[model samples]
Target chain A: MNTETIQSAIHPNQNHPNRNRPPLCFVRHAVWPPPRWGIALETPPGVGMKNWSNEFIGVDWGTTNLRAYRIGCDGGIQESFEDVLGVSAVSDGNFAGIVRELRETLGNLPMLLSGMIGSSIGWRTTPYVAAPASLEDIAAKITWVEPRWTGLLPGISVLTNSRADVMRGEEVQLLGYQSEHGLTQYTICHPGTHTKWAKVRGGKVEDFRSVMTGEQFSLLKEHSLLKAMMHGRVEPDRSFLEAVETGWSGVELTAELFTVRANVLLSRLPECRAASTVSGLLIGMDLRTGLRLAGHDLIVVLGDPALVRLYTAAIEHIGKDCEPAEGATAFVAGMTRIKEMIQ
Target chain B: MNTETIQSAIHPNQNHPNRNRPPLCFVRHAVWPPPRWGIALETPPGVGMKNWSNEFIGVDWGTTNLRAYRIGCDGGIQESFEDVLGVSAVSDGNFAGIVRELRETLGNLPMLLSGMIGSSIGWRTTPYVAAPASLEDIAAKITWVEPRWTGLLPGISVLTNSRADVMRGEEVQLLGYQSEHGLTQYTICHPGTHTKWAKVRGGKVEDFRSVMTGEQFSLLKEHSLLKAMMHGRVEPDRSFLEAVETGWSGVELTAELFTVRANVLLSRLPECRAASTVSGLLIGMDLRTGLRLAGHDLIVVLGDPALVRLYTAAIEHIGKDCEPAEGATAFVAGMTRIKEMIQ
Candidate 1:
């Protein structure tokens, strides 16, 4: 196989003639097989490439959902599958059986799993690679299951005198972003249940911070008194932008959170706008801390497009630069890199 | 009845010869009918006092619990009753029936209700009296129920150019504290589900702020991922104090909250200490905002003794002087003042 061809295909933008152009924005199309940003896998030109046998299955098994990708020998996604059978859903501890089913359905390819699947509650307990961790550091520490072919990627941890933060699956995406952009210094904001704000320096994760923004938003919207007012979709409306400003203003968050209820009681805010207002507040405060830890002018927001849009709006509102990237694409790129390393 | 006698009985500290002595500290004894702080009621000296027919029952119906006090003609608590029948427990909206049962169990005294009992979900929808409101303003706005003898006190609201805050039952406690201490200027911190921090000036509520600290703590401890590590009672140990300092240091609270779980995972903190650490972080952030809104040197913390102790510790840790007051005592005093006004 031609190593240069695989590298060029995986990071299309790096070798693109128009590399100086502004970064591409990834928008999700309504139909399946949507066009990718800059990745377009071309058939290799030689017999050795056709005979390549390094195909693999990448699985992101989180708490609520599982996503699987089938990577071709040329390091491009051939097909994908999704299911709600995440790590937490395996109540009977039949993770082996679940993976067996996946292997049967998605071809008998070797498996690489990430996320809570490697935690104590999942299939096995994998140790973490402390920061400053690089893609090579993570690739070297992969823990193999009983089956020699199945490997679990180690998560990353940052322990200091003042803070402790950990991320299981996002490290792969960070590495993918680093490989794709070829930038040694920047910040990446991976927004999710535990949103992580990581600073990358010299092509390695120097340190990072995690905020329970999404979790707090869910808890308040579903269980607290604010639930009654938190109806309707969270749009980036005026109420949301105004709340974003309030959240970013460094007000005491716990105190400011009560305004979501008080404003409704006083009829100053419509009930329908409560959800977006709360979303803005959480994301704004998230950026408030994230921007400080970022230590960079430009932020690369990697996540679902819907959430990325909100973060993009908030980041821009806070007078910072940000680019959106799809999480799946980054995940695939990251897995391919690790797969190459293992081979 | 001799009015001076009733006034002297209620304001025991004010009339005490050694009033210059430091304020008495109220500690809960293990036994029932624990010793009172400064109140020592004396029977009125006139025949009119014996026939004073102005006895009333004060009901504080909240979301999770109900507390009722029977006020004698001398404005002291003659008897008290408690039940889990808060307003939220009444699924059928039989508030009148509930009040009828209360009157039947206790005597057929005219009933005066406070707290969520006056909310929209309660028996009646009493309008809010805007601050700067005093006891007289709230008393004049009380909404009577179907029975002329039953009345619901109005809550207080602060709708300013920048913020909106509302309080139901806590208003009574603020008024009660003022009536007891006669402080023309002070700050009151009523710690509970939605802790209220109010500023009183010239014997009226100037403005206030509310923090969802208690509710957030409950939600995180019971529903979030932190619940797994949040075992054991939240004591005021070293872990709790250190967390309070972190919380009060103007750190991003949502980010700092995640440390509760990370610390335990990294072995820097034990699982049992998670609850107290979280408690400290929340209360520390609570004081961070409450102290700024207080605008006074000494803050009067009024609530259950246990919660009050936590807030007092946090307030002192923030380098502020604070005094602890019983919430029930303040409620009873406020109700007595309202009853006297209505009479």
Candidate 2:
């Protein structure tokens, strides 16, 4: 199928740049890293590929959403699909049924799943590789469910005397960013519901920490008394920056959070500014810890563009240098690197 | 008609000290302050007093609960009634109906309502008296919804260049504690859903701050991803104390909070310890701020016995001096003091 077909199915409203591009056409033995498995020449040409050995489906199955990428032999995304069928939605443990459906849509290529799909609640219980872990270390520990049908990427865990932290799907993005940039030492920040900050050294993830800033922000907006005052869109406005300054100044978070409501009540903060104020306060605190952990390493932030913009702004506001990257792109690159290592 | 009747109406399960005590007998002019209004001396003596002018109903109407105290002329609680009908429960703004019912049970005494009842959503939208507020300041700002039937105590607001904080019913408790102890300078911590820490100097609330520790703990327990691992009772156990120490050490709360889930996933922490661990972390962070604000002054914690126990333990664990006081007693004392000012 063409790019429009895939983009439309995933994001129906957004206009795509490659919207009307011709369907992908493949030639025999197109790129390097020759097919490892037996090649079938009888399958259709462009609609479906014959050599499934050189092609793989990378599924980033997280708690709330699933993103699948069809990687060609050239280490590029030929097509993609997105759905909200995450692990939490598989309440009946029918992960097999979901995988079967994915095969029907993305072709019967060997699938590699990451994220919470590797946890106990996912299709199969996969173990966590301890830090400092590398792309090779993670690929070596892949747990195959149906041998050729599905394989689950192991998550990464860091346990210390002071704290313990773990991540599943974000590891791929982190590794992808590291491999793509060819960086031997740098801090990678993947912001999401659980924002992860990982330190890389000697091409391995030495250690990391997770901050629940995004999730807590959602919780406060949806459930807390602060919900009443948190109206309007959360943009990086003056109020947001001011709140970020306050947060970065080392004020207590829980106490400062109360000021969101207090400011509204005292007529110091308007309702429209409340949401951004809350966002800035949380991000500022998250950055406070993140900067301390990063310590002299350049922070590479990868996530949704809106979140990236806010984080980048906060980082700069604190007079720190931060580079923005695309999380989806990193995931694809990481998956491509791992696919090459498999068998 | 007796203590048991009132105690059972309020707390049906807890044993009361004065249970089954004989009905109260009143002698005229027994207290220092004489009656201010008309003296009927016509109604039933012990069951319902004839003169409501010397007596008043003190109602602490909050967000989630309503507590009514039939305060006698001797500055004592003759009878009390409590229900889950807080301001939030009055969705249709039928606060008058609730007050009418409270009057029917507690007597036709003019009522003085404190807490969220003075908030925007309560019976009347009462203005907040600006700090530093004294009992006299709050008494003078009482908003009369119905001059003869109901009066709403003004909440307190502290506005500065850096931050702003407001409290509804807590001002009563703070002032009550100050007046009861006859202290000129001290710090008071009233811990609850929104824990309020106020500095009482010269018998006035100099300034105050609020931390949403209890509310955030409840939110994390009920709504966040951490909810899955948070099971069993949350006591001040070893896990709780350890988490508290970490929190008190000034770790970034959001980052450290994620350890609740991470520790569970890595098998480092058991499921039973999750609840207490989360509590200790939040409390520890709260105490870190509370202690900083309290400085060298003794912190008097007043609230529910269970919450007081936790705060007391956390405070002492940090090697700081803290005294536990009864919140209901403070509320009653403050109400009595305010009632006496209504000439």
Candidate 3:
């Protein structure tokens, strides 16, 4: 098999020839030729799909990319693969075909899918379960795609008071942490394009708020007038901390945003540090409002390590305590618990 | 000038063949062949430039456009001309050549120029007069480009409490209104790409805040995810009013913005009204912050009539009082006062 085929299974985002490939999953016995599917494979010289026999597959299918895992009966992760053919990339509703192809490659093992794959735009339209729901309630609502595979359409949590708010995929991640660790109540901050702060209580996600911090940062960095000064390279921590403090101090954001340009003009700030300041500003605003809604000083920050580190620094800088949770691991753990509940 | 030349003098943005043309201000006795500049003049049959004699020239030379006026000694506007060749369109520091050309054609009676033509990027760099200064102080700061033509380089006002904000071009308009009306204290709202709320004391601009509301709206409408829903057509008044009230009610703007999308998804709001809602939301935020900073309930709304109307509605909706001032008239009045001061 070409290294590309192997790598396609390794780093999905690097290549995806088409978005309409059929679902194909397998524990291969040998390095096989690159399969004719949408996934563009590029396995590094030393890495290839592992030869693992017979295990139930767990999948995290999202909007831009997806990862699949082979899980042993004891819940050990046996093998894994990735592809960039996300729901957004899929064309003409050919998801069933992609799934079939994945089954052909993986030997038709039973499978479980989560994330946006179960949303209105995915393989099947799955209704969102309301908040104050348990893991049992969430798993009970899984949409069965076929006899062998089921899609775990996640629940949506709503906050009626202090303004209307809602969340979808994050509910699964929250349940994952709760089910694996046996915890009841806590606040978790998931940082991404749309960051969410969830308040969990009595083994259920009670309320949540989605802040457009990450999205706003991206817009300002890449598209706004801030883009000019943002390109300068500088260490992000100091500027980020300063901006966080400024934002946390309750300055009006719209008025404060002009300072990004004014500081550069006045030479009080260097150009390279503008982006970090913007990041801190947005994050700080989110945290300020989030903390108000959270009603506590301690928060569980959940996401990838890179994002988690930033939040940890910001939270600690604000004089608050926080615990970090890795998102991928949490996703798998949540999937295993839900699979068990479904069976 | 040919009808095209006459119309070009009449409608500046319609044609400008060259940017380096002079400050030629004249009330032509008859329609001459279209004066060759960048504008390809094709004035429809009916329109032409008026002929008058011995009038002082008033010019508003901004970043993207220029307007030249012939005014009688009594401050009566005799004839006016326009062109798209503002300071930005001037190539290779040709300001002198442009002025020379205008002198050649219009026979250079005393001329007064204002706007960016006096800033660092314009014809000549002029120092900004500090704030809390009187109209005579501002008028005295006019930069004389030649024996016959003087450029008014306005000053920047500083706000020490919340943040630092500065404005150009609008200062002249502010002074114009103050000069004509003899006002001592008031707040003026200048609405445009970057809306300004300036606090005036004893005919001097004391403090001002530059809110990026208009810039932010354009970004959200043209670049943000909100663009898709904003394309629908609807009467803007209702949605604008509703959004303004929502913002004035102390709803956090960042969190409240996402409702523009959510409402469409939930069928709670019609898509056509999205733009109005966005306008109201942004204006409301500005008014809330501006009114607070103004430290008064009464404000003079000065800008183009369309923009002024919106701000007026928003202000009145919040139970505040406002007076509308036409931007062009105020600009001319301010120029007349400055010209008298300089001479």
Candidate 4:
């Protein structure tokens, strides 16, 4: 907000526009617009047409997971891929094995890597451009490495809050939104095991936070005692919605939470209603906390729509408004934005 | 309840008590309750009680963690030990190796083990007894073993509304309560990672439900995206209580729940308060859920008063009345009850 604060937000290392880095371990698959400004005049007999090719490819190679996208240049998607194998599998500096495994299906093409794969552990630490950084500043600082075998670029990590973390591919998501939406200021949320909610202004990400909603859900659903209390499937129950409403209002679940299961077990509620009740409690609590502080910020959530719906519905239940960013499109757009900024 | 329903609830196989099974392996420690009562009861040499002679020890070895006590026959505290080890450590039949490590300290002594240590995986799986199985059924069935091996007692497991789970040690806590305090149809709660809220009727634990509060809390605090946002130490912030009071009433948390951290990280709230807010959201939701359902029947939470206070306080926030089972002498009483039943 002030000169000193702004200066601090814009770190010295990332400001050099001329820094020579590979932007990121770029990975994307795209589907373009019907036509593009920079293409040959004739349309192929078998192919469709569009304005400004939007198709692009994206891969969010995080520390624990790998998400790949196939998109049009304008960020329309054609296909997507996911596998349990993550960068964590890349142990003992044998990144070549990982590169071979990841790229085996796709021909050699520019891939954008994000998350921890961009950390010093994954490939190499690409320095992060602090807040107020331009797409150019970020891309220009990419550290390109030609693997004597195959090179995997590590994502960049921002050091603050005394914690170490990398947001390699997410930066691409930020860049893409800036380019497509004409970035001035907006809030973006990318949900997963550890969901990252970020704020960007002037093509720069001002701040961010991470939540472990996905991981918690998985553990509770699979490993915890509460799992048996609910039916196997995620029910679209009314109780579920009520929980979302609670999360939107900022509820915390603790030992006292055991009652959801007890109620279901008691048949005090419909037998099928309990699992949804538990889920609603978790999601509702999340939304409530956010709404209490976030308060109707025009935000774009970049995650699965089902997940987005949970958040959006929770917010709306409490009279707040929200929109969802198509996860795949954001992935491609993010990579494209980085390319535009760098090249 | 109809005759059929009552018959199902009292099914002999379901109600039948467990018998000692030849262990797949042995316990690592020599856990024994002295003839006295397992609690330390030696009077100061200069003080009184040069009169007491017998020694007793009570050990709670459950599915996930283990805690032990050495008490004098008079039921006075002597020594205590604990470890994070639980049945989960052995996914397969590998329980013997693990026990070896934890039990090396206490040379050897007579011990009384309760909870899951009597489970199939703990010391030995005592068979299940049908309902109407009295204290005599339990104490008579207590499997005495070799000096170095732990003698375990089987617990009652309830199958209802399509839910199946076993509670090891809390059964003993309930028994101890009945032994020490004469009661019928009182509620008992043992709070932990998987907290068990039991319904006891006329000196028998009829049914109980396990809540994953502690596990969920640890997961949210340590492994989730929350870990990135936090500094080292964490206080038992009332945010947990607040979240419960404020969280949506009917909803569950299993669905979508990442926004809490996102709101905090974007500095929507101060970092100092994020943990509490998160805690409150989770615990608050939990409290409401617990109160809305079965725990109202919870007359006595049979553990330290602190746990009783924590659980009861949350319920009070929602205008529910609760009593803590602190220092009520349930253990020795439970021992007495079981001993009398055996006699």
Error of 1 at A273 (Å): 0.8
Task: Give the Cα lDDT of each candidate.
Answer: 0.78, 0.80, 0.69, 0.53
Candidate 4: share of reference interface contacts reproduced: 0.25
Model 2, runs deviating above 4 Å: A1-52, B1-53
Off by over 4 Å in 4: A1-58, A68-82, A91-94, A97-107, A132-134, A147-168, A269-275, B1-61, B64-191, B195-330, B337-343
Best by TM-score: 2
Order of the predicted models by DockQ, top scorer first: 2, 1, 3, 4
Taking the tens digit of each residue's C-alpha lDDT, what string does model 3 give over A139-164?
78878776435465665745343345
- Please identify which of the two predictions, 2 or 3, would achieve the higher TM-score against the true structure: 2
| lDDT (Cα, tens digit) per residue for candidate 2, span B112-160 | 8999988888877899888999989998998888664578999999998
lDDT of 4 by residue, A1-343 (tens): 2223222222223433312422222223322232233434232212232111333335677765666655445445555556433566544555544444333333233445566666645666665555545566666666655421122333333345533333556667755776777758777766666656666767776665545556766766765656665664555457777666645554435433455644543345565666677666666655543443344457776677787766666556666667777765665776666644433
Better of 1 and 3 by TM-score: 1
Write the number of the candidate with greater lDDT, choosing between 1 and 4: 1
How do the predictions measure up, each by TM-score? 0.85, 0.87, 0.78, 0.55
When 1 and 3 are scored with lDDT, the better candidate is 1
Task: Report how far residue B14 has shifted in candidate 2, in Å.
Answer: 27
Of 1 and 4, which scores higher on TM-score? 1
TM-score of each candidate's B chain against the true B chain: 0.84, 0.85, 0.78, 0.69
Ranking by lDDT: 2, 1, 3, 4
**Model 3 segments more than 4 A misplaced:** A1-3, A6-125, A143-162, A232-236, B1-127, B134-162, B232-236
The candidate that wins on lDDT is 2
